[model samples]
Target: MKGNFNHFKILIVDDEEEYREVFKEILDEKGYITKAASSGEEALNILKTHSFHLVLTDLIMKGIDGIELLEKIKEEYSETEVIIITGYGTVENAVAAMKKGAFTYFIKSHDLEELTIEIEKIRKIFYLENDNEIFKNQQKNSKYMLNTNNKKFIKIINMAEKAANSNVNILILGDSGVGKEVFAKYIHSCSERKDRHFLAVNCHAFSDNLLESELFGHEKGAFTGAIEQRKGRFEAAHGGTLFLDEIGDISLSTQVKLLRTIETKKVERIGSNKTMDVDFRLISATNKDIQKSISNGEFREDLFYRISTIIIEIPPLRDRKEDLPNLIEFFLEKSKLELKKQIHTIEKKVMERLLSYDYPGNVRELKNIIERLVVLSENGIIKDIDLSKYRVDSERDTKSREEKIHNNKEVEEIQRIRSLKDIRSEAEAKYIKKALEISGNNVTEAARKLSISRRQLFNKINEYKLR
Candidate 1:
């Protein structure tokens, strides 16, 4: 081991001079560049002037204590790994120290053989990780198939690819269901970190404290129910990518921590003084208007700037109607394969209806609509009649009529002429169809959308011959 790792550096920190000397002598014999500190303060002072790959520190020290020293080293020298040594019957603190970012811990009373083996194992891991990163960086560039029919949409994809080639942070702006995560993944797959971890965290899903603990990791005893130390997204995504979805939803306090971590390239786990170094390219997405969020004091402006060094604003489906045909074809094929159906054609009128509607849910909604059509199709071919039952005619037509009514007396007269029951029936039918469309014809989902029971929706579908 010494022959192979002669260049590896190790630091030993112990208040007891004899123990420090003994450890240093063993490490020196093994050909490790060894340094010793009699106290935590001395260790820190040595660290300020020099650097080491690993640290061997006693759990109980006279001055700063091993835990505090571990934290300071981890925060300052994130690349440096620490291993805590404990006296007899202090195994729990050693374990706790491991949770606080120690690479591994050792029993002070034990022989140096076990400690040497652990160090050797860690050395192998470092080599493996470095080799893996190199392999990932050498893989062929990932292909991107973004819709290029719309110039603005094409521009965004092109811009994203350019940003991906660099190590810059990116922020994606778009409406919900607009495939922000997909875009993020595309960037990751195309980036240098293609084969590395690509972890995504939805900021809105967890509470403030939970989110903090989740992103920064936490000690075993960090909070209630934190039974064991856990690595967070940031740690796990080191040398890779981290996609923070719905970033605007994070609380102000968490934002501050996140900003500091991004600036320092370091993170402190909850209930742990240690700050670990993380090297990840962050890609954040949000449907919320971040500018508005900043003005509302809901989001941090400086943090936003740090995150949005390269911003890609995705166009809504409505703005990219030219891509509808291509999108429809893409989704149509996807749905067919997913549903295991052979849908070869769609009627011209059905295509027209699909292309005309303004999809509030964007591409996702369109994909669901195509899937619903495929699931509900009786024949292999999709036709006007099959789509007619699931038409959004009522809602679209109603809006048109309302607009006309506001503009013309003749439209108002026509509305007045219709019976109340007829108007109500029209609305009910339109809403039921909309619900069915949104739910992909799943009775349960349609019912939920309509705020009706499954049985009620079934009854309405039968009564209206909606099937």
Candidate 2:
């Protein structure tokens, strides 16, 4: 068990001096730079003076219990991992501590082997996470690909690339989580204007006037909050590709201005009559059916024709079940590297169960599921994943999703023939996709409707393979 991580820094917190000293002596014997604190306040003060890679704290104390300490630690130092120590007397509190952001928990008076092993595991994970971030950043900074190791993705990529090389205006159609933005980036990266800026805008993020000002330049004092002159996406991306994500979500008035920009390749800034030429390529995405919006009179017809010269529809993940194996492998490797866990493999049972899932949210949802497992699973292997605990197999989850879309009320009630896991997973996926559609992929808005955190939404996005 002796390894390079022997030099890792550690902190132990307990109100009992003898208990703290005992653990400190044991840890020090293992060559760790160990520190001890008698209370949460004392630990916080010590933390302010110094930093440690890991903190091991008792779950209960007189002042500022372990849960509060965990909260404070997570808030101040997001990178630092903390584990809660509990006796049989307060076992539930220890588990609650984990939810509050404690990395792991331990039962006091038991063997210290698990704790020691967990520390080494976490230290390795911390380093791996650092490396993974660098890798992801590099991928972002450099040219991005479709991340598709499959035929359909390859064909889609080819189609988008061809459209980009040509002079056709592109309208990318897909349900949310179908990697529309990734496809958009691919088109830009492969285009002749690859050297120019690629500007992407979510049409629903701002109010009509604000969205207008964002697309076209705005003069100072144009509106109450217009404090300074600003260049819009059209101007900034003059010689590049302008990506309009969720184009169908924009208001009717804003759509008129957008039509003008694409039709004339010119824009007039707000509060100014000066026309500016924008020699740029146009690419737009929409989860909604523009034809429906047009029929409903919520979208502009001429603009739809103008943007749909080349239309590419992305397939949802459920339609491409064959790619599940590769996607899982990709996410597994990604999570292992990111989480700094030697999770070299997943259990056959878990994999088989995962493959059975419909994954309504798509690739994004799958990543979140895998990330959650990587974080919460004991040891380096994810064995018996409690899908029910994760809301993956809940009647409430599936019911809410179906109610939102199919009936706008409730669908015909039927006896649930499938396992709770399958039902819940399908339900959760639907909710995410619909939320993205409703909120136009604005994380905050989606979180509001789903009643989850932006972080949780982000996590689920990756877990369920939503995108």
Best by TM-score: 1
Q: CA shift at 207, candidate 2, in angstroms?
A: 1.9
Q: How accurate is candidate 1 locally (lDDT)?
A: 0.82
The CA lDDT of each predicted structure is 0.82, 0.79
Question: What is the per-residue lDDT of model 2 for residues 1-467, given as tens digits with 9 covering 90 to 100?
Answer: 22345468888999999889988987887678889999999999999988899999988888998999899999997878999999998988888778888888899878998888888789889876765575446446333324555688678777877887886789999887777777777777778987666778877566687788988979988878777788888998899889998999998888888888888999888988899888999999999978889999999899899999999998888777777887777767776887688775567767766776777667677766776677656767786554444445334556676667675433444443668778778888987886687567888867855545676688789879997
Model 1 earns a TM-score of 0.57
Tens-digit lDDT track of model 1 for 129-201: 8766754533321122264588888888888989999999999999987778778988997888887877888
Q: What is the TM-score of each candidate against the true structure?
A: 0.57, 0.57
Error of 2 at 345 (Å): 3.7
